[model samples]
Target chain A: MNNPGMTEVLFSLILVAIAIAISRFWKINVEKDIAIGSVRSFVQLVAVGYALNFIFDLESVWLILVTLLVMALVGAQAASSRVTKIKSPFVLILFSILFGSFVTIGIMAFLNIITFEARYIIPLGGMIIGNSMNASALSMNRITSDISSNRLTVETALSLGKSWRESSALYFRDAVTTGMISILNSMKTVGLVALPGAMTGMILAGADPLDAVLLQIIVMYMILMAVAVTSVVVVELTVRQLFTVHHQLK
Target chain B: MGSPSLVVSHVSKIVDDKKILEDISYTFYPKNIYTILGPSGSGKSSLLRLLNRLDESSSGEIIFDGQTIDSYVVCELRKKIGYLFQTPYLFEKTVKDNFLFADNTVSNSQMLELLAQVHLSQKMLESSVEKLSVGEKQRVAFARMLLTKPKILLLDEPTSALDPSITEAFEQFIQKITIKENLTTIIVTHSPEQAMRFDQTGILIADGKIAESSDIKSLLENPQSDAGKRYKARELS
Candidate 1:
């Protein structure tokens, strides 16, 4: 398949046009949103493509690390904004995403599954950070809502001479499970349901079918591990803030 | 009496610039049942919470056993000061689980004994708490709290969900344990009749201050403070 230039990209806007047409015809009141979203997505992707081109050309290890840090910060901000109970969840979210993503990446490098080059690290780091961000957000949100809604349950345990950790142990399991549920479901229905992004992109880029499948499998496991670690870390940090040093609910 | 097992010196709690408790001072003696009587939202529960350090006082000192409550490890302090909620909460599953949750060292024999004290049968221990009546659950919660071997017990409207018979029985059970275990038992009740039934020293809280503190009969009949007179006249509720 020949790599079509700007014309193909422009032609894709026809699909966006059709979406806007339908939204307007049905009086969904989302035609403006769809149009704006389409334009935003186009601009963001194009900008990312150019940036990646420049970074790949530079091939600086420090530059790659800086990019990952920036991505994690941006991802953390997006996750923390979704949670309203906690006053400032940004630092914990950032730490969780960084810890979860880098730890997996570190292990992958140690096992020689991937190299330290910009090509491999940046893309895989992006995937890891993105998934971990979602997991952290989901876990934090679930635990907060669970604890707040079930104050009697939590306080009962506390009044029974239990520590904060013991009082909320059940909630931790629930919230972490909630965080990991998506990945678990996706893992179960991976190829059977639909082609995931990484594998589909690899195949479209003319990689061998088996190679794409192998990479996709690695990506799936990486996400599962990252999500697990991130959710647990974020939930632990978040729950600590909900109680005082005296073990009282705040 | 008995060197004041617990003492609160000028305790006050302010949340969001609203006073929940103000300059509350009290001395709790061991082996005595003290009833805290108040109307709804009068900070009866808030007073109990401060004793157990479930909620911190804004400006005050709580001395437990000759030392400030802050001196003891929080978990150990909580263990020593057991609390029972108004709507009794039992962990899902058997009554035995609830007992074990309070104190993992609780034995089957001990569980059975506490259950018996609460007027529950041994068979009920194995039964799920969800299937038990509200009164039964309150008794189970009472038994479980006793399992911790606390030095003090804070009962927050513990019999609110019980019938007349059960409430009487539960009150008698509480009286028995306070004497038997030498526990400083503090019970919070909104009803003046319940306080009279206890026939103990009563602390009347009205608008976050101690309205009266004396023998329940004297406090109810020959009242002193304005709030106490209003309470006797059936006006504060």
Candidate 2:
């Protein structure tokens, strides 16, 4: 289980070469994307590897917090970009991902389930933020569209003396359910249908198979809880955008 | 004898710099049918929305039963002042479920009575709302409105979907309920004949203003204002 050195890594270029060659033969026209993607992945991962090495060496709490904040900002922007209809998705997305990622990390660190070190926090924070980002974006988009398209239903409920919360309750539920479906499906099919990234990465990095399974379980639970929080927060903030204070549809 | 059931005082609605309703004032008394006759864009629906606080007015106040509308909780205000839209929206569930949506504690016998009042069979309660025809859905919506025991009812073209025959029967059923329940009913309609047939107060709205208000017959026979005259002319021709 020796680590793959520079030669082996450069040899992986052949795989990308084969993909580009096939695309060229078929005239599929994605050769540029394939080539750029291969080069981009190599650069990004190598840069991250060096940066993480420095952060892990430092072990400064402030440095970890700063890194998490930067990740949160980028994650929020990426999440907000997916929701086109919302008025201003930045604050909602930022707070949601931050809340979901840090809250889970905070609880884990408090209980000593995961250490406060850079190696554990950074990777785990990335997982939590990544899941929450997807969940927030998806839930926000679904809730906004559902409430807008079901204007008649929402208004009818409002007219029936139902509060705005009660009026959009169904859509909120549907949106959150949609956001968490990925996590739920992954949870159900874990270890059977697929070996997830964290688990596979752990195994490839020479961790014991049992240890990888244990870490994967923790990651899955962390993702589920984070996604749930993100979905709920985004739905709350996004649904309010669709109505006036007077309970009228915006 | 007492204060009117509902009052819209100097209410105006503006959205996105466009005036939807302006400087409209009216008092709706109990146990009377007030037909709000207007052109397509005359703010009939907007006015109805403001009454129950579904949409707030940009200026002015609405007093419901001697208390301002905003003073009451919004949900309770809507229950006290029910609204039925032109194209009724029923939750995609059984008729019984739709009824329960308004007041979950509604008794089965009360539902039966309300349906009977709207000329609907009690057996339809078990059936899903999707199975009902448009006319049936309209009647069910009417029945649902009654379930709240609202003192004021705002209807925006409730019969717009029904055929001539169903509309005729609906008119009769609605007139009966207005008198029997003593509900202050504000109905918006395109047809002047329905307004006249109801034989009650008529308010002619044009360009978001009340052009004229009087007994239905007098207003129909002799409208004095320019907008009223125009509406009468169009109705006749």
Candidate 3:
């Protein structure tokens, strides 16, 4: 079977044209960003393509470790950008993504559900870290806005002899719950309503349907675990810094 | 066994190179109403916030009871000194929730009785506080303050947003709460008439300084400083 390279290029051009038309109709200041992001995405994907080709050939444990570290660092940087008020936010993001991805990957490897190999490790680690990064960013942003906007409410509670944790409990709960919504929505729509990329890719590569389904289930469970642990831990740690030792909002 | 309710020793506050309050010293005793009369931007609000350590002074000490203000935990200090804003910023909750802010465990009957003390209807409790009139909200704020049973009440133009009749009612409510609760009250108001209604001891602040500190009648009747004379003429006019 022949790959339709020209058809793919024509489809990409049509999508770009549509995006530009929509932006103009909506009067959105998105032209420059869209152009820049498109170029950057192409460059990034080409670089990743070459890197993955080489990475697949190496088959070394150290190379895999290095690739995972780079991914985690990029995830941390992305998460930190969403929360500028928080000093040392990179530390929180680093720990969250690292711990979340490692734990998920470790459990799968230990269970022998997925062989400890480059193809599985790289893609699985990337998915876990990416989802955890997003969850942490969402939780932190919500928590920061909630604390600053409702300073009086928190202070009022604190004055009434409520502990810092007790005072900001509602805000913390709201942030975590907000972050969890995406995961919950995906869970609701998975398998029946939509086929995820991993499952579809495995099926396309001539893998058995049952094996592909099992892998998808494991990946979904790992994503949920990663998001939950990262969001809760990061939010709890960062919230403590918002209050002073005197129980005043900082 | 306790010292005066509040004592400020040579307190000075500077923000962004401008002096808001400079070298202010005074003592407030328990069960007395002390009114700080000043024009807009005269640091009247800043002075009130200082007492509760909401706004820190650049120098000098604020001693509440026997301990220095800095010695007490800010949250604990704020609990003891209830600070009410010019505009009643009621939460997005029922009137009952507003009072329950200080202590949620209080019985509904106790809250209703307290509301009655402030001349508020019991029906107001179940309604949304956002829907209340300015006067009604001010009264609810007073009721809310009473829940904490604060040792001192610092009011920054509590009736500023009300109409004439509502202002008069608010004044009466202040009088009732001060006497009934035995609260040491420091009220900051621009209205000389309201200041005179509250207490005799009045401190007039002008150009970020205390121009006069005396009885309300003395300050109003026998103006001494140029600022005081000008203030008196304006009030009379």
Winner by lDDT: 1
lDDT of each: 0.91, 0.89, 0.82
**Fraction of native A-B contacts kept, per candidate:** 0.73, 0.85, 0.24
Q: On residues A1-250, what C-alpha lDDT tens digit does candidate 3 reach at each position?
A: 2343657865787787788888889999797788788778878987997898899899998999899999999999998998877788898878877877888788889999888889889999888888888898889888988999987777556644456888899899998877777887998999878898889988878889889998898889989988888888888878987876656577
Q: How does model 1 score on DockQ?
A: 0.84
DockQ of 2: 0.79
The residue-by-residue lDDT of candidate 1 on A1-250, one tens digit each, is: 6586899988988988998889889898899899899889989989999999999999999999999999999999999999888889999999999999989999999999999988999999999998888899999999999999999999888888899999999999999999899999999999999999999998888999899999999999999999999999999999999999889999
Q: Which CAPRI level is candidate 3?
A: acceptable
Record all residue pairs in model 2 with backbone atoms less than 3 Å apart, i.e. clashing: none
Tell me the deviation in Å of residue B114 in model 2.
0.9
Encode model 1's per-residue lDDT on B161-187: one tens digit a residue.
Answer: 899977898889888889988889999
Model 1 chain A is weakest, by summed lDDT over 10 consecutive residues, at A1-10
DockQ of all predictions against the true structure, Cα-based: 0.84, 0.79, 0.24
Candidate 2 accuracy as TM-score: 0.96
Evaluate model 3: give its TM-score. 0.82
* Candidate 2 steric clashes: 0
